[model samples]
Target: MAYSDIQKTEFNRVTENLIEITWTYVNLLEEFPRLDEQDSMSWKQMFVAWANEFEELYGHTNWIESEKTYPEAVEEFAKEKILQWAGIRKYICVGKHIEGITLNPYEWLLEKGQDVKLFESEAEAKIYLKTNGYTDEDMEFLKFEEVWH
Candidate 1:
């Protein structure tokens, strides 16, 4: 399963927003010398300055700071969204016909209805199959397919 068009669009939007926010932070730090002075401002004041600078530059305000600070919220949100997107990915070893039969290792593993092993990489899958009596010739027929749900 792959991501839906809407999910992909949302992912792109969030990623772009994160990039813009990072650039905004960088630009603010470069433009305003006082923002970097930790001794001159408390955490709350620093956050207010950051939020004000972000609003001034982007013309948009964020209220995520009410629960957590702006920086913390941004970091947490980005991490959560990225992890959510990543969690939907699934991988399997798909076998193509080479020696007169399509021998799908993943299918064989799943047929028992037990815990089927999922590989993260083609190399890892290939190694596992080879170690488990699959010859190099058989390995040539293996393909790694990524399914995103």
Candidate 2:
């Protein structure tokens, strides 16, 4: 069901505050001066999308994690999941997807030697897709533009 207008407003406010605080903590750890605003915004968007996917996959049941260290282990597990998902999804691509039963072009691009690759530029991603047999019409997906840009 769709959220009501009030719910949307509240959610937007809450998400904004939560993300800003999280970014502040991240910056404290990174200790880099003057990080790019665009980069933080991109990360915030990607994290939100990943969180939604995570909830869909594992939020229905209150399944307790099996770790001896209690909450710290759970925290570690969550952090690892986010890092892995970011590595996979935080890149420009034509028609990107994160998971699959079998490895395929849409799932992750591979170089000529079959090692996985992430596109550094939109042009590079487009060229890679075409070289791998994606046609002009197929290139219309532009996954990053819709989701991350």
Candidate 3:
């Protein structure tokens, strides 16, 4: 893509202003040096000082962030979260759409006039039934089915 002279000038001005910062240093080489005048450094000097704390910070923060935009990645992540919150989806994936037909097994059982006692574990059911005064013989003739989510 070609940019007009005005656009290039405006873009350069913006980018230049974005990082146009100065750092004051008495002596960069020494810890604390007393001098009549302090030396100034560019924003890059401060950036490198901060980057020295981590090995990957410089490349990731400087190169990747300045080069790429993250709205696409954010949109993809947000799509899955929205689908999960809605508890249904028309499509199964982020790309190359595969139709998703959502069905609730508990709802299906209710529609069929089947009793569904949902307990994550046997211990949970035992605790519930025992608290509800269900006797050992009352548990007889009861069936259990393993349903996958």
TM-score of each: 0.33, 0.30, 0.23
TM-score of 1: 0.33
* Candidate 1 per-residue C-alpha lDDT over 57-145 given as tens digits, one digit per residue, 9 for 90 to 100: 44443555366565555554433333233344446644454454655333434334565556766788777777889998866655566
Candidate 3, pairs of clashing residues:
none
lDDT of 2 by residue, 1-149 (tens): 65554443356433543454355436433533333333667766755664455445444434464334333433443444444444423355444545532344455455679755566677887787788798877666446431211
Question: In model 1, which runs have C-alpha deviations exceeding 4 angstroms?
Answer: 1-86, 97-111, 114-116
Residue range 13-73, candidate 3, lDDT tens digits: 2232222211222122242232213233433443344323222322244435554433333
Error of 2 at 17 (Å): 14
Q: Using TM-score, give the best candidate's number.
A: 1
Candidate closest to the true structure, highest lDDT:
1
Model 2 poorest 10 in a row by lDDT: 28-37
Each model's lDDT: 0.50, 0.49, 0.35
Off by over 4 Å in 3: 1-115
lDDT of 3 at 119: 61
